[model samples]
Target: MDDSSPPEPTGDGHYERLSLPGSEFSPLDALVALVRERGLFVLVAGGVVLLGTAYALAAPSRYTATSTVVREAQSEPEGIPSTLPSIPGLNIDPGNAGRTGLAPSAYPNLLTSREVRLAVARDTFYFPETGRRTTFVKHVNQSPGAVELLIDYTVRLPWTLMEGLGRLFRDADRRLGASGARSPLLAPSEEEQRALDALEKKVSASTQGTGALGGESGLMVVSTTAADPTLAARLNASFIEHLRRRVREIRTQNTMEHLKFVRQRLAEAGRELERAEDSLAQFLERNRSVIAGGGAPTLSFRRDRLQRQVRFKEQLYGQLQKKLTQTRLRLQRQQPVITVAEQPTPPPEPSAPNRSLIIVLSVLLGGAAGAAAVYFRSVLASAEAQESGREKLEEIRGSLTAEEIVQGVREELGRT
Candidate 1:
């Protein structure tokens, strides 16, 4: 009959509930409970934080050096636009000018390409931890550092296992590849190509605008990272140098080959011109009397022919020499497909092992772990309390999802 008292159980159906005063829920009380039982949470959190600290300490520092490259950009040459057809109606095409287009967008790929990479490797020496006669490819893949070694092994373990499993599905593929089947889509690359693949992982490239008008606004950025700062800088520079050289070769290859041919002809012409001069001299000496008598038309004709031959040879040689000079200039001018805006310098400090960032992240991670543990324990405690209350206490009706809220309500009521 009284509102505060427990109702008697009905004999026909329902289970009887024990009356409980001040047994309710709220967030503040749940928080108090968590604080009271924070030991496990603290331990878990501390362990996580400790692990993060250890990882930070064990992680090796990495130095990053960047090389800024500016694309040469496109512009009309000094003379006529040879690329543009002289016909009455046709669009201009720079690629038709017999020079490879120096496109900025393609620089990233060219810089990291196997050809440029291998060329760089061939020219450069290995950087001894301090900073190589060996191929740059071999030099770049030197063994990992202690920390790096640990990480590589640890990280690669699962991948290694997965690779083995993957191979099971590709047995037929392996056989086909081994048999050298000519599939256009899936041809195998050379070992050097695979080496370039690895080298590419260490190198990165990007582009920016130079604020210039027209199609030449692209500024390329190429960067590389390594354990040693000097090595990073040197490798980046080497890659750029080789990339430039490669681009120049590609653009001027035809002209250079033609120039070589011209030079050979020029050499032959020089010999012919010398021989003609000597023969003409001998003929003039032998025909001295005939020339004075003005009766030797054949001798005169012979002398005239030799003089013409000498002049023709000299003219040919001059033209070839001029052509060779022009081609050399063209090659020199086209060599700056990608100019170094800024060379890589040995970084003063390591880029990785970011200590402050590690510390902050570690604390956040630890705090999250602690919070999760607290929440889990809080839920478990609530479940147990609910079970016990079901057995020995009366249920209160406030809200269907008000179990925790009721518990907090009880705590405040008891305190008052």
Candidate 2:
């Protein structure tokens, strides 16, 4: 063998290291080879670990603020039962009888709804990191840091290029010109939509319970993640506020509609009562002597009928008045949809970029990479001694080249 070539195994167990004619080298032999080349493995692994640490330090920190809430059911009147007296045009069927606005499972969906997201987006917030007051959309679209920009140009180049090209082809005149006067009924602007999308990912709601056979324990958690701890807490609070407001609106819709109906009916009953009273008053005025004394049967019968009609109208008017009062009371009794069980607070530590784990994984990957690289280099060096193997190595290098592939793509796009 040439002095530059690797020596064949020649230890007492070298015979065991040799494989059968048709088989590959044993795993034990590979392990022995890696052990012999520990220097290269350590160098690569250490470099990879150092890179991981750098990445962890440079990456944006994410702080998650969480708020725990309990779903509060709407309370019934003190003396009221599950069912109420049926009315002619009013539906007394209890709307959301046991719970508040919607099921606990539906809260996640409600928190992500367009209405809630838009409201939160338009609201002004104070960001301590920037020491500026800005809307959610502006805060979300703030310029990135140097590391973020570098990542966007490197690892995220494909996605970044796509976004850039999309913007280039977009109708800027239509979007920015006076012709962009969007109707009040139109969807949100592009920036608002992007902010809303970010909100969808950053803000989240989840329901948790003991999983009892009975029912849900009515516990929910709302969380918001951001680069700034205080901002995360503030965003969580905003999400909770909007979520509660939405729930209140949904829960009270039925009661409000019923209140309107009651008011209208009460007015009609009052009018009816007035007409009946007037008719009874006129009849008694005309037949005062006949009613007081024993008069004709027909006249007495007419008098009795008029008095009964007046009484009936009076009863109906009183009932409606009572209903109106009760409905108003119920509206007042409507409790808040959610009660804050645990207030949101800024987290001290970051929730992401586990540097230790990243470093550990990087070390392992680099070691494997280095071992495979060393093994392949030795095999190729040995193979180069044969003409056939040398030709195959050249073929592999030519196939791996990227210049031709890039040129072909450019040509294709030019033709298009």
Candidate 3:
């Protein structure tokens, strides 16, 4: 046998041979032994199952509710402009309209804005059963006499030692150039920054998804979430209503203003036209005999001038009539140009607290923890066995050496 190689088993079962260096035990045998030795693995797995069951039972049940609002495009009028002259090779369709001012994607952010939040916050209750009220902050000032007493009791003072050190440092700073040095601090104005601080706590809004819903013509859905579902729904409805009102009001105001200017211009044109007709009539009356004497030049000139004046007045009047009709349509509240395809409904459930997902995660986590415990326990048991075997090997080596020493001394005595 080679000394470098490990000793092979003699089949008499004195010792077992290792396939590799330093491996005296089979993994399969170790596992079997571990299974026989440790009842803790079963206990740990049972504990894990128990904990998982407890978590599933103890956790709060979560419910989700969603409400959708479909944004619709503004309706267009049915007919082409009467003034647009028909010509060859010209293809004009009234249905080919420009995009509406409002967009579905834009509404989501507006639902969560401070403007919407403040509006909802001002209202006390959407429905009486919810029993929720809006809360506002109020600041009160202390009376002059109580101010000093309140300050003395409430204000924290510096330690005496620290105060003394601070005084020394302050005196040194005052004596040096530090006293007159400029500070680098810059701050926004109170009024300008006041709204910014309240923005986050005030409003919450989000968009749901992309594309139109249900293959509906010109319909886009937007959804908003809030602490209060009723308020969220109300705010969303209000935002859409507000947007429509604003668009209409703005358009109406602009159109009315333009119409007023146009009407004034028309009035001025009418007056000018009347005066031109009167002057032409007088000229014709004065030149009636001259034109009747076959002077075609004078007759043609007067007719042409009068025709031009009539045409101009007619065109101005026509434009004003068209503008007036449009303005009237815009001002009418009954006919909303941008109609709400779907009204906002109070959500039936909160759109959060996904319970099923949480329970699944808990089970997975418990299994992983149980597996880690089993591995750690096995490793610790193997380390302990290795330490115990090393100590026994040291003791055996010491005893064998002592016996050899005794035999060597006995042999020397016999030789003597």
Winning model by lDDT: 2
Give per-residue lDDT, candidate 1, residue 143. 68
Candidate 2 regions exceeding 4 Å error are: 1-24, 35-47, 79-83, 88-101, 158-186, 211-217, 271-314, 378-416
Judging by lDDT, tell me the better candidate of 1 and 3: 1
123-207 in candidate 1: lDDT tens per residue? 5555665344566655545665786556656856786567456555465565665764565224333434445555777788877
The CA lDDT of each predicted structure is 0.66, 0.74, 0.50
Give the range of the ten consecutive residues with the poorest summed lDDT in model 3.
135-144
lDDT of 3 by residue, 179-287 (tens): 3544322222222223223333433444445454433233444454445666557655655665555555545675566556546755766676687778778877887
- Choose the strongest candidate by TM-score: 2
Model 1 lDDT, residue 300, Cα: 80
Clashing pairs in 3: none
Ranking by lDDT: 2, 1, 3
Query: What is the Cα-based lDDT of residue 223 in candidate 2?
Result: 87
Better of 1 and 3 by TM-score: 1
lDDT of 3 at 314: 64
Candidate 1: minimum summed lDDT over ten consecutive residues — where? 85-94
